[model samples]
Structure formats: structure tokens, C-alpha cells
Target: MLPDFRLTDRTVPSAIEVYGIQGNAQYVARKAEKQALYAREGAPCVEWIPPDDLASVQLPPAA
Candidate 1:
């Protein structure tokens, strides 16, 4: 799957996902699947649920 932002420079696999849609059930399911895939691959991710979780989402330090 294509991530919203792929952190290619990180020492380990990493990505940033911007979850802009929350009202649709299919989109929500896909989001969960993607998150699970990333976790299973041992990649660090920053998920930004805009208008709410932006401040809470902490990005990983630069490599």
C-alpha cells in the first residue's frame, strides 16, 4: 500500500499516514488494515487524525 508519506531516510522502516476520512466504514476498515500491516512489518508510523489528534501524533526523530 502507498503511504501518505514514506520516510525513506529513516534508519528503520517508517511512514506517516494522514487519516483524513473518518465517517465511512470502509475507509475506517482499510485504515485499520494498513496500520496492522505497518505494525506487523515492524515499521514506525505517525498517524495524524486531523482536527483532533494532530498535536498528539509525535513524529519520529530524523535519522
Candidate 2:
């Protein structure tokens, strides 16, 4: 079964923001599939870290 999904478009100066909602939906779908597979194998699913923690990670410069 697929999870419920929604999308909203917004005008923004950045290309990233324009595409952010679609990107987020893709991420959720991927994570949900991983979680479902883990559940089927009787393995613990990893919890997502809070956004603040994610934001604090130092990412390499974008190519």
C-alpha cells in the first residue's frame, strides 16, 4: 500500500524551494519502503533524526 501524499507549489526565488516539495515526497517514499522491508525482516527501523540535528551536520560543498 502506498502512503498518502500531498503537494503544494509555491513561488520562490530559489530553484531548490520550487522543487523542495517534490523532493521531500520522493525522500518519504524511499524511507517508507526501507522501513517496510526492515519490518518484514523483524529488524528495528531506524528513527529519523530531528531537523535541527540534520541542519547542524557539515556537508561538503555542493558540486
Candidate 3:
């Protein structure tokens, strides 16, 4: 999966995705699929939904 942001410095796999479009059926389905994939892979996935500013998002510390 291509994440919006990837933390390559982390010891474990970490991904950050920004979901800006909420109403589209295809987009929502894709988001769910990605979440499931992350869970199955035991990766740390962070999801960001608007209207929260990305600048204020609290990201996990790098390793």
C-alpha cells in the first residue's frame, strides 16, 4: 500500500494516511481495505481525517 507518509526511521513499519474525501463510496471502501491490510500486517497505521490541520497532527516519535 502507498501511504501518504511513511516513517522509514521507525524500527517497525509505520504509515500515515490522510483521508480527505469522506463521501465517495470508492474512497471509503479503499480506506477500509487499507486499514485491514495494515492490521493484518501488524503495522502501526495512523489515519487523519479532515477538517483537522495536518500541521497540528501529533505524529509518533521517530526511532
Candidate topping lDDT: 3
Model 3 segments beyond 4 Å from truth? 53-56
Tens digit of per-residue lDDT, candidate 2, span 1-63? 222321223231111111123347787777667567656865432242344354543322332
Q: Which candidate has the top score in TM-score? A: 1
* Root-mean-square deviation (CA) per prediction: 1.6, 13.3, 1.8
lDDT of each: 0.84, 0.39, 0.86
Candidate 2's C-alpha runs over 4 A off are 1-23, 52-63
Candidate 3, which ten residues in sequence have the lowest lDDT sum? 53-62
The runs of at least 3 residues in candidate 1 whose Cα sits more than 4 Å from the true structure, single-residue gaps closed, are none
Q: How close is candidate 1 to the true structure, as a TM-score?
A: 0.82
- Candidate order by TM-score, highest to lowest? 1, 3, 2
C-alpha lDDT (0 to 100) for residue 2 of candidate 3: 94
| Residue pairs with backbone atoms closer than 3 Å in model 2 (clashes) | none
Candidate 1 vs candidate 3: the lDDT winner is 3
In model 3, state the lDDT of residue 32: 93
Count the clashes in each prediction. 0, 0, 0
Instruction: Write down the lDDT that model 3 would get.
Output: 0.86
In candidate 3, which residue pairs get closer than 3 Å at backbone N, Cα or C atoms, i.e. clash?
none
